[model samples]
Target: MSLTRLLFTAAASVAVLAAVPAGAHADTGPYRMPPPPFGSPDAPGADRLTVSVVDSGNGNDGTYELECGPAGGSHPDPRAACGRLDELAAAGQDPFAPVPAGTYCTMQYGGSATAHVTGTWHGRSVDASYKLTDGCEISRWNRLTPVLPATAP
Candidate 1:
């Protein structure tokens, strides 16, 4: 299988694994969104972000809310996303850094999916875009797996 397919499969797996049970019932009407697994309203400098992805070519689009310092959000895998960010912070790496030039990549057209993440995290503002237009971009996109949907909307 191709690397792109492998990355997609891994992301899909994460999403499925992180899914929470819906507590909806007839008495409650629509399902009440679950409280976050971590973090609290009173916590100082709690992280919050609004993430979105749009692929006009393939009609994949979605927007979700993300809060960390205790992962919680509409994001499919909040814990993983937050963990990635934390790892970057720990290593002094920039999550939004441009993929290095001349990096070897296959000439594969994964998709035209484009995603953007905005909001605050780790006490800093975030405004980032992700795409799968080429190998380097695909690598970057994969790093954000499960945060952005793997399939077209």
Candidate 2:
């Protein structure tokens, strides 16, 4: 091949290689589900609850819904309090990182209650729980509380 033609072909190949998307460059490996929410169940003054997040990889964003109740009673839907996870992801924020470590009030009589969350993640469903202290005021279900590395499973 002529020197000029050879050089042109090499440069074109390099350019095409560079144009590939970064994510495409690497295999994301197997799709591993995120760890479950971490927190103690109930203490002397602590109420326990579960919080699960389903990472729906669907381009439409994810949803976070919660059902809460007392330690041994029927659970009620508290979806309104849990807010939308997809919205947080859109805002570039960790969707589950604001659930405070305390008690929360039930959506009904403003009574104390525990929390159970269910959502979709990477097209999969997730469910977790949380126990709050007595007389806890669940004004609003913030993002999932920060899970300490030591406590994560």
Clashes of 1: 0
Candidate 2 per-residue lDDT, tens place, 1-153, comes to 999999999999999989986667466666786543332122122222334332212221223223322222121333322223434444555443444566454444322234445443323344544433322322233243321001111
- The regions of model 2 sitting more than 4 angstroms off are 1-83, 97-111, 122-125, 134-153
Clashing pairs in 1: none
Give the Cα error of residue 75 in candidate 1, in Å: 1.4
At residue 69, give the lDDT of candidate 1: 69
Model 2: which ten-residue window has the lowest total lDDT?
144-153
Work out the TM-score per prediction.
Answer: 0.58, 0.26
What is the lDDT for 48 in model 2?
25
| Number of the predicted model whose lDDT against the real structure is largest | 1
Q: Model 2 Cα displacement at 66 (Å)?
A: 9.6
Supply the global lDDT for candidate 2: 0.37
